[model samples]
Target: MNALFFISQIIGTVSISAILILALAKLFSRRWRGQAEPARSRGYAVLVTGCDSGFGHHLARSLDLRGFVVFAGCLCPDGDGARSLTLQSSSNLKILKLDVTSDEDVQQAKKTVQENLPEKGLWAVVNNAGISHWAEIEWSTIEDFRSTVDVNLFGCIRTSIAFLPLVRASKGRMVYVSSVFAFFNCLNLGAYSVSKRGLEAFADCLRVEMASFGVKVSIIQPGNFCQATNILKLKTGSDIWEKLDSERRQIFSRQYIELATEYFLSTCRAGCEDAGPVVDAMLHAVTSARPKRRYLLVSAVDRVFFQLFPFLPTVLTDAVFSLSSMYATRTQMLHAK
Candidate 1:
C-alpha cells in the first residue's frame, strides 16, 4: 500500500512539472527568433519527392490543402498509391515519376517542374526521399554504405541543383528531411548514421551558399515516425550474405534481419508523431516570412540524445551497440544462438 501510494505521488508530481514546462514553452516559443512566424500565406508552388507514401506523401497533401501548388514525385506515378493521391487532389496537384539516382529521370522532372510553374517559380523544394539501414558495420560493405549515401545525401544535392533556377527566381527555400541520426549514431545503423552526418555538413554548407541568392535552406531532423514504410528493407548487404563465410553469414541471418527491421517499426508505432507537427514545421519553412536554418522535428528527448552522443567515448557507444546486437541475435529462436 505504501509503495503504491509513493508511485502515485511521483506520477502526480511529474505530471504537474510537465504541465508547467509546457506552459512556459508555449509562452517562450512565441519570442523565439529566426523561425518562421505565425500564419503566413501559401500561394507559392512547391515540389516534394518520394510521395508514394510516408512523410513525403503526407507533406505533399498537407501543403496542397494550404492552397500551395504541389508537384509530388513518386517512383511510380501510374501505381496505385500515386494514382490514388492524384485522383483525390484537384488539378493543382501534379505527380511526376523520378528516381533521384537516375540522371535522366531527375533531368526530366526538373524540366516538368519548370514548365508547370506559373510566372513565379516554386516557393520551396522538400527533399524527403531517402533509404534506411540497420546492419553491423563489419557485415555491411562500402558499396552498401555508398548506396545509402548516394540516395540520402548526394541525391539531395542533385535535386537541389536541378531546381536551383526556379528556387532562385522565386527567392524560395530548401527543406531537407534529415533524421535524428544526422547527429547521433544508434545501434546497427551505421549506414544511415554516416550518411546523415554527411548530410548535416552538406546542409550547413548549402545554407551559406544559397543565402546570398535569397534562398533559405532549412534541414528538418524528424524522429522515428510510425508511417507505413521504413529503410530496414534495403539489402545491399543481404544479397551477398551467402557468399561470405559461415561466421559472417550467421550474423546476417534471416531472423536477425527481420528482428532488426521490426524493432525500428515497433518503436515508431509507440509514438503519436501527428502529421500536425511536421506539417506545422513545413509551413513555417515554406510560408513563414523568415525561416530558421534548422528545424528539429524530434521530441525534446531525442534532441538531448543527439547532443549527448558526440560527447560519449567511442568504447562506451560501441559496447552498448555490441550488446544490443547480441540481444537481437538471441531473439532469433530458429537460429538458436
Candidate 2:
C-alpha cells in the first residue's frame, strides 16, 4: 500500500510539473495571446482577397462591424459586389485591387504591406479568391485545367509566400477558403474538386510547417449554396449551354431547377446571417492563444453526402451520382435549346 501511494504521488507531481512548465513557457515567449486589440485596430487586422463577391465581401463587412481592420481586395471594383463594399466607410476598412492570379498584383500587395504595416505584421491573410468549372473530366480542356490551377492553387501559393513573413511575425494565422468539395466528389465538378483537394493538402502541410514559426493555418469549408452575385449571369448562352438541347431544358425546368434554386437561395439566406460563425472562427485563428486547424460550416449537403458516399459500395455511389446527373443533363438540354 505504501509503494502504491508513492507511485500515485509521483504521477501527480509529474502532471502538475508538465502543466506548470507549459504556463512558464507561454509567459516567457510573450508569444501567447496578446491583450485584446484596441477598437481602432479592430479586434484583428485582416487582409482578405476575392472580396469582389460572395464570402469575401460578406466576411469583410462582417469583420468590420466587429472592429477588425479589414483590407478587402479583389480583381475589379466596378461590379455590384465591389461597389457595395466600396460605398461602405470603415476607417477600419480599406479596399484594394488584388488579382490573385497576377504576379504584379501580388507584388504590389506585398509593397502595400510594407507601406501600411511597416512596424506590425498583419494579423491574418484570408486567401478567398477562386473560380470553378463544373464539368466532367472528358469535357474539361487542358486550358480549363490550367486556368483552374492558376486561380485556385497557384494564387494561394503566391499570397501565402508573399504574406508568410507577416504571419510568422505576428505569430498569426492563415485561413484557406477551401470547399467541402475538396473531400466530397461530384461527377461534373471535376476541375473544381481537383483544385480544392489540392488546397486542402496545402493547408495541412502549411499548418505543420508553420507551427514552430509561431504561425498557424486554418481551413473554412462552407456548405451548399451561398448566393454569390452574378451566378445567374454565368455564361448560360455559351457553347457549353448550347450542348443542353431544348427537350432537356424543358425536362429540367419541370423537374429540378425549382427545387435546386430553392435549396440554393435558402442556404444562402441562412449563410448570410451565419457569416458570424465563420468570422468567429477566423477570429479564433487570429487572436486565440491556441488555434484550431480545421473548421467546417456543415452546410455543404451534396459535398457532405459525397464524402460519405465513397464509404458505401461503389455501385451504390454510382447510382446516386447517376440520378443527380439526370437533372444536370436535362438542364443542359434546356440550356442548349
Candidate 3:
C-alpha cells in the first residue's frame, strides 16, 4: 500500500509539472518568430477567397488598408459583404466573383487576377473560403460529408492550384485559414472536423513541396469565431436535424434536437467576436519576410481542451467527452419527461 501510494504521488507531481510547463509555453509564445524585413505592400497583390463574410472579408479590407492591391473574391459579388468591402476601400481593392466549388468560376477569377497583376506578379493568395455543418457522424449522411469537404477542403485546394503560378512568379506565400477543429474533434462537428483535418494535411504537403520554389506556405488555425464568421448562423444542429428521415429522427428525438440546437447556439454566442487577431495572423503570414510555418489563434478554452487535452492519455480524453455526452443525454431525458 505504501509503495502504491508513493507511485501515485510521483505521478501526480509529474502531471502537475507538465501542465505548468505547457501553460508557460502558451503564455510566453511569441506571435511571430524572428524579426523579418518589412514587406513592401505597394505594387504587391494578394488574392483572398470568401470575402462574402467573416475572416476573408475582414482580411481583404485590412490588407487593402496596408497598401496591398487586394483581389477580394466574394461568392456573392453584389452582396452586402462585397459591396461593403468595395465601399470601404480604395480602387486598389477590387471584388472578384469567385465560387470556389465551381471550376469555371475559379478559372475566371484567375484570369481576372492575371489581368490586374503588376509586373512583379501576385504576392500572396489567402485561401480562406470554407463552410461548416453540424451533425453527429451517425446522424449525418454521405452527402453532408461530401458537401462540407467540398467547400472546406477542396475549395482551398482549387484556389491554391489556380493561384500557384501567380504566387510563384512573385516568390510569395500561400496562407490557408484552417480551424482549431483540424487538431481536435467535438460532438456534432464530425463533418467539419474531417474537412479541416484534410486541409491541414494538404497544407503540410504543399508547404514541403513549395519550399524549393522560394514560396512559403502557412496554415492559420483560428479558434471558435462562429459569431464573427456567421458560421453558426449559416447552419445549426436544428437545421440539419430537420432534414433527417423519420427513423433517424426517432433516434434523436425532437426534444434532443431542440436541446442540441440550443447548445450549439450557446457555444457560438460564447465564441470570439473580434476577428482582428485572426486577421493579424493572416497579415503576418502574408507580409512577413520569414513567417512561421503555422499560427494558432485559439482561445484559452481551446488551448486547454483541444491543445493540451491531446497530450493526455486516450482514455482520459474519452472519459472527458463521454461525461459531457452523458450529461447532455441526461438533460434531454429530463426535458422529455
TM per candidate: 0.75, 0.69, 0.83
Clashing pairs in 1: none
Which is the winner by lDDT between candidate 2 and candidate 3? 3
lDDT score of model 1? 0.76
Model 1 RMSD vs true structure: 11.3
The digit string of per-residue lDDT tens for model 3 on 7-86 reads 99999999999999997886466333434564599888999999999999999999989898999999999999999998
Cα deviation of 301, candidate 3, in Å: 5.6
Q: After superposition, how far is residue 77 of candidate 2 from its true place, in Å?
A: 3.3
Report the error of model 1 at residue 202, Å.
1.3
**Model 1 per-residue lDDT at 65:** 80
Error of 1 at 306 (Å): 3.0
Give the alpha carbon lDDT tens digit for every residue of 33-125 in model 2: 555442234444788988987678777887787777778887886677777886784776777779999899998887876677624558788
lDDT by residue for model 1 over 1-337, one digit each (tens)?
9999999999999999999999899647855744444333345689998888777877888888877789998988898869888877868899999887778889999899878885555878898888876666765778879999988988888888888888888778888878777766665678998988888888899888987888888888776664544444644434545445688766567666566556655665675556577667876888777677777776776677566666889887666665675465555553575
Off by over 4 Å in 1: 1-43, 226-244, 247-273, 308-337
Candidate 2 lDDT at 251 equals: 48
Best by lDDT: 3
